[model samples]
Target chain A: MLKENKKELESDVIQLVPQLTLDCVIFGFHDSSLKVLLLKWKGTEFYSLAGGTVRQSESLDKAAERVLMERTGLDKIFLRQFHTFGNVERYDREKIKKMLAHLIDPDLWYERAISVGYYALVDYMKVFPNPDALSDACEWWDLNEVPALLFDHEEILEKALHALRLELSFQPIGLNLLPEKFTMPDMMRMYEAILNKKIDPRNFQKKILKSGIVIKLNEVKRGVAHKSPFLYKFDPEKYEEVLREGGLFFI
Target chain B: MLKENKKELESDVIQLVPQLTLDCVIFGFHDSSLKVLLLKWKGTEFYSLAGGTVRQSESLDKAAERVLMERTGLDKIFLRQFHTFGNVERYDREKIKKMLAHLIDPDLWYERAISVGYYALVDYMKVFPNPDALSDACEWWDLNEVPALLFDHEEILEKALHALRLELSFQPIGLNLLPEKFTMPDMMRMYEAILNKKIDPRNFQKKILKSGIVIKLNEVKRGVAHKSPFLYKFDPEKYEEVLREGGLFFI
Candidate 1:
């Protein structure tokens, strides 16, 4: 089965667009810090974002969506293309050839490479990552503790974060990284995680009330020390409209 | 000389990255409308943005800047890559083959293509358009009067304009499309052109004054049918800083 799979992979690789790859920077809010989805390559010290080469018939955006779904079981989330990484020496071609010597032709592997970077904000609890043959593990890594990435992925991630931050200051996008029926405090945490700065709770509540992106649910939480904050869910129609024409940011 | 230039172009075409092109959407503000730079292909009824194939060694961004300079005779403009067009049939293969059959191998000319779109705002008076071999002329067209483009350029231009509008609402970037010295009325006109709506002059003046991106020049303009408006220049140091850090838009 493995041999047959490898043969199919080789055929697909031959059909793939040469020297181009699609790397996804998937950001999710979990615990306190904003986290990114990363894959640990099998039998290697390097890790990378959920990424793959473009197929012959599909667009780069489609390839990115396919890769994100294959790695993290995510679908229907909008992945925004932030930038393309095309530095001549972004990746060590010789080192990549050495690493994939058993799997691919070194000459083919060493072609001057370029990759487009796409990013999406997904709810941390919803995504269940499943690594493929190239990697042994897929997990969320805290942005602060992100270990050394394989190539210029670290730079790509940095740019993605910067784009996200700029949007956060103007658009209501942090909700995508929060679960439905979340408390105001969790939403605040998500904003803080993306902004990397503390947002006053009162200020956030006031701004959110004016933004009209959130709908207050009738039910309140029971598990709390003093009082339970009312749960809220995003108004899908309003959110989609705002997503197209951005809303005022809480900041 | 024409044949020799054609031969050199063929060589450069051979050195280009397979199936990938770079198209630039150069925007300028003149009179009262937002304008875009476009090229007229020699034989076709269609026109398109100033665009070219990417050389094998240079990055896509570098290729875009080169195309911009070669076409407009302007340099030092920083273009931002807004999107990539990668539909399988983005450009008609049969049409391309018929167009380039005499110059290139039809097999090579008809490869499935993708394009990266870059946009820049430049002063209209500073740009001197130059047409290359494949094109008969290059000119700035009002955004409303843009003719039917050769391929997906129409779509690409639309996306670029959308990005510029989004940026215009938050970033003080429209100054690049203006003359170095201009009246407050012209500045307001630039915003109206970009935002595609009339702005309250009083409000715009209030915002620009508070933003401190513009300097009150010692000289004032003597114009007919109106009181003399002060000539203003961008505070180079502060404008550069706002450009780097993005100033508040005069929306």
Candidate 2:
């Protein structure tokens, strides 16, 4: 019954002008550091986040996946829609009018585009990202070292970071950043990196241990400390359940 | 600087299909009731919530306001965008493709239309609704009495209700539903209506009092069989601050 309606909607979308695009805020943790994926635009000093337009035949989710694959070379990862950016001034139409007064045709200069923001958490080591035709370089920037970004991209990145922090408050995240089995210090470092704060070591361990989401492994760290920290692995099943129940683990 | 980009985006949208619709889930509280504004389509048995298409040169938010005003004769009420219903199946094209196969051209039937969902909170008694050209009647249905709605409207309403409930948990809402000054019972009834459950009277009162977002009016209800409940009014400044801080108050 719903299939027929879907077909009609697909046909309708094909007939309309393609004004929608998907902008991704891809976050990755590496070397106990928080980073975001960005593309340095070719021929310009500006860098932008990895993003692309939605195809007529694709769902918004599919479009986001396509963008992720094309930009990051990652086939599948954890990606979710966070919000849509649609303020009238978001596109900054007034400035465009003056800049393109003579260089570009006026008719082609002003095009209204609304973008859906998608945030993805991925294993940084697994993906090999390549810049598209319009970009010079595609790379990960430490959250603290972000350069000037184009088209409200900075604002978009900030929103994604805020959402990620909130998600961390409840979910057992940053697992993507670690190996299958990791030490407590490794996990704590990831938290400290993303939070950009020095947490009390004793208190942090106590809070996380009480949450019961993490399971301690008999294996210990291999090197570099007076006493090796115990290895831990996140229980995905329990982590998901807690997320579904809207539970939060305070730091 | 951003204005030029916005102009380009706007022009791009115009090149797309012409139909841009605004659908609203207008919620009202009456007689300890929680209700939603809905409409009956003119030629079909399918009932729907109040909605309409946007005119050329009109902003999406303005389109929502216009649709709200045209249907309910209410202005300056609190309205917010919850989600954009742009799934390819939004229009039920396959049914239309089969049902109007002979009468309507397939090209016309597939014309893309994007509808934005906005939920509004208004005083039920203040509205004087008149159905639009596509609808037979405009009416309010108790939240519990919602029938099968047309298109993806049921899903839209569910999402809106979820957002509303989340909003209620953090903010002292439903001020628009009450008179200038209302008794504690009136406030409690509204809370129960939105929460959709019987709450312990003592606990509910205690929780609300502790939040300190509401002010006691000193006046009391006059025409009740039991002792008159003290009147209360929401402190707008405090309520705003609570909402800003993401404060939670559970009943």
Query: How far off is residue A151 in model 1, in Å?
Result: 0.8
Which CAPRI quality tier does the interface of model 2 achieve?
A: incorrect
DockQ of 1: 0.54
Q: Give the per-residue lDDT of model 1 (tens digit) for A91-171.
A: 776876677565455554434767888998887788998886677899899999999987678888999988887777666
Predicted candidate 1 versus true structure: per-residue lDDT over B35-116, tens digit per residue: 9988877766558888887777888878888998898888888588888777677767787567645544554443466778
CAPRI band for model 1: medium
lDDT of 1 at B59: 83
Those runs of model 1 whose alpha carbons end farther than 4 Å from true positions after fitting are A1-14, A91-105, B1-14, B91-106
- Chain A TM-score across all models, in listed order: 0.89, 0.84
Instruction: List model 2 lDDT by residue over A54-139, tens digit each.
Output: 65565677878888988878866788776666544565666644443343234443245666788998888887878876677999
Q: What is the C-alpha local distance difference test score of each model?
A: 0.79, 0.73
TM-score of the second chain for every model: 0.88, 0.83
**What does fnat come to for each candidate?**
0.35, 0.07
